[model samples]
Target: MIRRLFSHIDLMVRLLVLAIVLASVLPATGRGYVIAQGVSNAAIFLLFLLNGLRLPRTEVLRGISHWQFLLPLTLWCFGAMAVAGKGFASLADSTLPSTVALGLLYLGALPSTVQSATAYSSLAGGNVANSVIAAALLNILGVFVTVPIISLLGGGEGISLGADGLLKVMLILVLPFIIGQLFQARAKGWIVEHREIVTWMDRLSIAVAVYVAFSGAVSQGLWGKVSVGDWAVLLALVTGFLLFGFGGSWLCGRMLGLSRPDRIAFLFAGAHKSVAMGAPLAAVLFPPAIAGMVLLPLLAYHLLQLVVSAPLANLLSHDPNVG
Candidate 1:
């Protein structure tokens, strides 16, 4: 009975909720902010390093070789989703805050999740190899794609990155990744052996980033600016966004004539966004006051997708026709 109850709960979602609550209640003043930022930065780098060490290079190459699945998945995740976000934001401008609207756009531009997407793909009896490749490539490119996309979307008000700033951000993230990759062949067994620890480290870093971002916003009167009604509207908008992504991707996958497993790959990989990438990117791209709001939609979408996808994965797994 206890196991069943625990299985139903989303621990990551709970952790995020706790972070927000703590950020609101705690005094994250000068010293707190300094310490949090320092810790958050280190965590972010380590998270990427761990990812590089664990990334399956052979699977990625094999997945990419199958262009039939790769092409549509890429289009949906990067191109189509981004345009949809802009359209939604424009349509809802009067109701949603500018920061929140931009947050939706940020979500659209961000990459598909590697771990969750792959896990769901496997659960659903999908083409796990292809899912891994699609997810991996999207994230690898997201660091490059996201910055330019933000710049293109009216970056005059601090959304823009100067050449040096862009270079620095790239180097900070990319250098660690390269270093990890270099050590991966030698360290792969050890890294994979301690996979759970690495996973928790990544989650902890994101939680800390959330705490730091929200604490800064709270200190600057975040709750004062946002209303209860705003939360309701944001919830609805985020739900709609997820539905659109999932429905559209599924339809496109079918229309493109992908096989069952390949379609499942697209369905899972194309429909989700990465909070791991989103949180750190927001920290780099937006100021603290607005970063929290920018993060709000992502937090909502991330939790929503997991909740919705899990049941869908279960359904697909049980269906004899799916695999």
Candidate 2:
């Protein structure tokens, strides 16, 4: 009986960890004020630090050359999604805040997540090293360049970018990642032996993030601010964005002349945005009310992709070229 349950045990364990975190929050709403805020902030900071430490310094400064295989199509994929959402925004204008329009646009403007790209690349049999390097660089550069795009398309309610933002990116994100990497290297053998521990943190972060997002909203009584009708519209937008990512990334993969495996990596890595990154950026870029609104799409997008993309990823990896 235990053996039967142990099939895909890693995935099961991950889900279990998330469930535990969710359970923890249900008790006191996870709103220990300073404790919650500090832990949440440290988790993201430490997560990035691990990223920095894991990646080569040279690569961080001067990324992999796969843009020949990725950039144009990736940009166009995100661009078209932004246009599609805005095009249809008129239908839901009455339900969500006008800022929802800006939130949708701004989240699309941010770069894809680094770690998820690499994780999916490995799962799909892509060049893991290349995907890892590319993902890290794109995110680092995104901190610098993502702001201008937001400013241009964000109309008026987007984030501000400059030296200050860059500093925050480095201190909060880059430094901690470097620390994690250095610490990992010293204990490289130990880490390898304890791979399960790191894996636990990966899933645990998602669970923590979900609980924090939901609990924070509940604690503030902000859950009441948006009604069922508004939620329906948010769900619709999330669905559209996920599908757009899948379809758009596919076309980009073709345009970039990627072999099937590379295409699979490009599609998942290049297209998935980080709510982890977005939440902080939103808080910095917009007003509190608007930032909360901005996070809605990211929250929706994160959950939708986790469920929808497992099957999609499996299908992509089975392609002959991927094998």
Give the candidate number with the greatest TM-score: 1
Candidate 1: segments with Cα more than 4 A from true spot: 1-7, 154-160, 320-323
* Cα RMSDs, all models: 2.2, 4.8
Clashes of each: 0, 6
Q: In angstroms, what RMSD does candidate 1 have relative to the true structure?
A: 2.2
Q: What tens digits encode model 2's per-residue C-alpha lDDT throughout 159-186?
A: 5546776676667666776576667567
lDDT scores of the candidates, listed in order: 0.82, 0.61
lDDT of 2 at 164: 79
Model 1 has a clash total of 0
Model 2 CA lDDT for position 315: 63
